[model samples]
Target: MDTPQNTALMRALTELPGPLPARGVIHIAIRHTDRFTVVSNDLAQHPTLSTVAVGLAVRIQSLPQGTEIGIKALAARFPEGEKLIAAALRELEAHGYLQRARTRLPNGRIVTRTVFCNQPAALLRTRVAAARPQQPPAPPQAPALPDVQQEQAPEAPAPQDHAPFVALVPPPTAPRQPSPPLPQPRELTAELDRAATALLSDLRRHASQLVLSESDVRQLAPAVAAWLERDTHPDTIRHTLTNDLPQPLRHPAKLLKHRLTVLLPPPLPGADDLAAPARPRIAVTPFQTCDGCERAFRAPTPGHCRDCRNAHGPAQAAAA
Candidate 1:
């Protein structure tokens, strides 16, 4: 116990401060072997997200799949209210940490499918790479021999003029073709143009993935006006654009442009004849005089009334 090593350790312990500085936080780190979630610095020290949102994301990432993380479920579990939980979820979605898609089952039931990304940036890169066309890799070249080997084999014949080395060049990549132009709207009015612009700008409020740049809004405004011209309600337009959105939506403007072009409603009928036919009216049976009792009753042909039929049946039975 009184060895030189023990004495040195005791001296070192005494030299160290009894307590850490009275300022900043000190972490007593532990090596956890189990039941610990690994959170990335991007999320743990998020510059833009609120504390609630970051914490919520961590909690969600730790949970198993199919666990309920809905606003109601989270509100029940945590001290936060439903409103706060809902806002935090929206924040996560906006920042690419969460995505919710409404999918219809084979049984015609609609359910919300949620996907959480711990590394949103990595996921985005993966998606982009997958979407890009794959190019053939260049062939590997043989390694050069060491200088010592060359010196030892100085008598070896050099490459002949006929066998001149040719460099291996990669094939040229095809240029990306420009996307086809979006269909133009019918003659736009001042009011229609303003409404369309407003709708495009306001899309972010409903779905944050749809936040468009000013230039994008200007470009896509006419297509939206076309929808309005077809008498499509604003709510309908919003739902169609925002619902069932793909996770990690890389190009919102492009997606919106495609939907506006392809999903455009047919123009309202111009003439009465062009409109859908009116529903057929039901025909009522005509009232006819019963042959047996001279009673008025509904029938396709002259027939005995129920009372007359019953009376005749009893009389016939009595006679029999």
Candidate 2:
């Protein structure tokens, strides 16, 4: 039973803070009395991992092509530093959330690439259909260069043609940097946001487990689509979400998910049964303790017998 306000989700994260990164754009930063958690949206099947993965993935949707991102560049966005990503990547590999493919860069350095594909099975085809390579905006037609008519006149008849002093010189130009292409279209940003939110909702419903590599949690939607549509191979989902995607789409979800992955514990031996699941620690007041300072507090709640909870807030207990 998943819902918009899933208590189980909150409890799960509060207990296992390791997988989530404490900070970063593509991570989830969850602070508790004990420590921090970082989760990775780039990893697959990340269950109990934070939902922040979706927005972060979408955020990296429009990175410029030919740019290779590393851990340092990633740290600028989310709290999940490079170390956590390395760990998450391995964890995801273990869970089959991502497939690790090594590529030889132009400099001959081998680098691993991860793909993210977290769409629902039913919608994967639709998503892939939508994810076809889109052309970048047409450079605004170079503003037409204000085509000025030079009106070249015969050399001998120049006296009658504006005193023949017309020279074919270009007009004084405005500053070259045209204000950075108007910061992209607001409509496009909103569109991506809508798409990301929808995909996120779909993911929350379909993902049964989370995939982690080292520690980054990859979403499973794009993978679903890839599995269904060979034409839209999901080879780049991982890197796109982590380093190549644009802004807006990679909002809080991914950043939060990354934060969650940081809190994951080391792998247990054998067939995964030894891996005990974490449980939430809720502070409860005992039924028979002093009402004043409910130490393990034995006062019946709502009785106002003695704890500061009666006087102050429900979270803190003190003598009344």
Q: Encode model 1's per-residue lDDT on 1-320: one tens digit a residue.
A: 56998787666655665675768854445589999999989999999999999999999988988998888888888899999999999999999888887655654345787888787776666556656989999999998767864455556788674422222222234476677677677788999899999999999999988989999998999888889988899999999888878778999998899778767777877798687989999999999898887989988888888888888998999999
Q: Return the top candidate by lDDT.
A: 1
Best by TM-score: 1
Q: All candidates' lDDT scores?
A: 0.83, 0.41
* Model 1 lDDT at residue 202: 96
User: Worst 10-residue stretch by lDDT in candidate 1?
Assistant: 163-172
Residue 54 error for model 2, in Å? 4.7
